[model samples]
Target chain A: MDIRKLVGGNVARLRKKTGLKQEPFSEAAGISQSYLSQIENGHVNLTLLGVNDLAQALGVPPIELFRELSEMNPD
Target chain B: MDIRKLVGGNVARLRKKTGLKQEPFSEAAGISQSYLSQIENGHVNLTLLGVNDLAQALGVPPIELFRELSEMNPD
Candidate 1:
């Protein structure tokens, strides 16, 4: 899959795993809801710091945002 | 390590691993040598597309660029 798609899916799943909706999560992540929507839709080409910012909001390491599902679970 | 430093070092080492100098490699990567220099120095914020671009230039998967040394080797 494309990295964009992979990242988007991961973001969506992780956000759901944390028990927060887009509004609350985006606020915690310091991004607007519309922007987070775009991110979750695989439409944004994020800056390196943007990756960090999102990861920080999600409490994951920056690299976790980049890994494939297989690499992430490894099981 | 900081992700910027991690990415910078990976770029430099991968470029070297492929036996290409910055000038030629940057030319092949379609980025200016100065920008490639900044990337190698960990002073730039790359877009997701930029990550894909650099990984393409290095002939590695995009996720490889985000991996640490240990992850790369696993040995």
Candidate 2:
């Protein structure tokens, strides 16, 4: 199902929806900009704590990142 | 808000709901039993890949773990 890519896509989408750049968003999330880029590219895995931090910074629930999974083609 | 505890509690609850011991479940999830125990205790951080793996093993969506956050006393 490539959940990592799905999650990464959603994170990037949500970040863009806020009209904030990776630098400011990563700073607000207490993560490095490079890490954020890796996350957006599905190149890195994240802890549950990281998910919470990013969600808080983005003004959303952590589960919001997975909201689109139902619509994704898991095959 | 102690998100770690909340998440740990949920993971434990879901695991118990299946009536399977940690050993079998951990094996199914491709993690060591000790590591699963730590996760159940909220003492270890998990990567996003870990979350997906656990969810797949548990036959649920990864977001299911966070579903109870709203009802939790965050203070």
| DockQ of predicted candidate 1 | 0.69
Residue-level lDDT of model 2, residues B14-57, one tens digit each, is 89989999999898888899998988888877777877877788
Instruction: State the displacement of the C-alpha of residue B35, model 2, in Å, after optimal TM-score superposition.
Output: 2.3
The DockQ score of candidate 2 comes to: 0.71
- Docking category for candidate 1? medium
What is candidate 2's CA lDDT for residue B40?
A: 81
Worst 10 residues of 1 chain B by lDDT: B64-73
lDDT of 1 by residue, A5-74 (tens): 7788789888999999999999988889999999999998888888878888888877778778887677
Candidate 1 CA-lDDT value: 0.87
Which window of ten consecutive residues has the lowest lDDT sum in model 2 chain B? B66-75
Model 2 agreement with the true structure over A1-71: per-residue lDDT tens digits: 56677678889989999999999989888889999999988886777787888888889877777766556
Per-residue lDDT of candidate 1, residues B17-65 (tens digit)? 9999999999999999999999999999888888888998899877777
Candidate 1 TM-score, true structure as reference: 0.89
